[model samples]
Target: MSLTRSQVESIAHLARLDISEAELPVYADSLSKILSFVEQLSAADTSSVEPMAHPLDGESQRLRADEVSETDRHEKYQANAPSVTDALYLVPRVIE
Candidate 1:
């Protein structure tokens, strides 16, 4: 469950992070501890456990009624818009 300096460097490169040489040892030790935790988690017996949608219960999360009950002030909302066309926000074109 130990991580090397080179492995840490590779992980940093893949994550787009700039890690200095002095920071490599610190990162390697931290990564090694995480790997050890994963190894410990792998030792768990999950064969008898049923898959659950939630930690407390498998029931779906509560949600508000789908029917619209409130009205929005569209004119006030659009007042602060930087650019608007036909009651809609105008965004910069990203594609040709």
Candidate 2:
């Protein structure tokens, strides 16, 4: 899975990277090696491996009770606003 100079340039352009002409060859070689390594890793046999959601499968996640912990202060906060209607702030229309 070796990457050519043109392929590297296209990848850089798609990723919004500014690869200078002097560094294109370096990037090409580095990206080629990375793709080759990924190919090698993909060739490994993992048919017997079981999929896992978490590495520590024996442990359960502790969760706190879902409850309201704070008092509503919308009226107090809205008092400072210049314009509010139906619990929503009104702003000047800048676009038609």
Using Cα atoms with residue i matched to residue i, what is each candidate's TM-score against the true structure?
0.49, 0.47
Query: Which numbered prediction scores highest in TM-score against the true structure?
Result: 1
Name the runs in model 1 displaced over 4 angstroms: 48-96
Candidate 1, residues 1-96, lDDT tens digits: the string is 999999999999999999999999999998899889888777888989886666767365778889998798878899999998888899989798
**Backbone atom clashes (below 3 Å) for every candidate:** 0, 0
How well does candidate 2 score on lDDT at residue 14?
100
The lDDT per prediction is 0.90, 0.88
lDDT of prediction 1: 0.90
**lDDT for each residue of candidate 2 in 1-96, tens digit (9 for 90 to 100):** 778889988999999999999999999898888888788766778889887788788777878789988799999999999999988899998799
lDDT, candidate 1, residue 74?
A: 79
Among all windows of 10 consecutive residues in model 1, the one with the lowest summed lDDT is 51-60
- Output the lDDT of residue 43, model 2: 79
Off by over 4 Å in 2: 46-96
Native-to-model Cα distance after best TM-score fit, residue 85 in candidate 2, in Å: 28
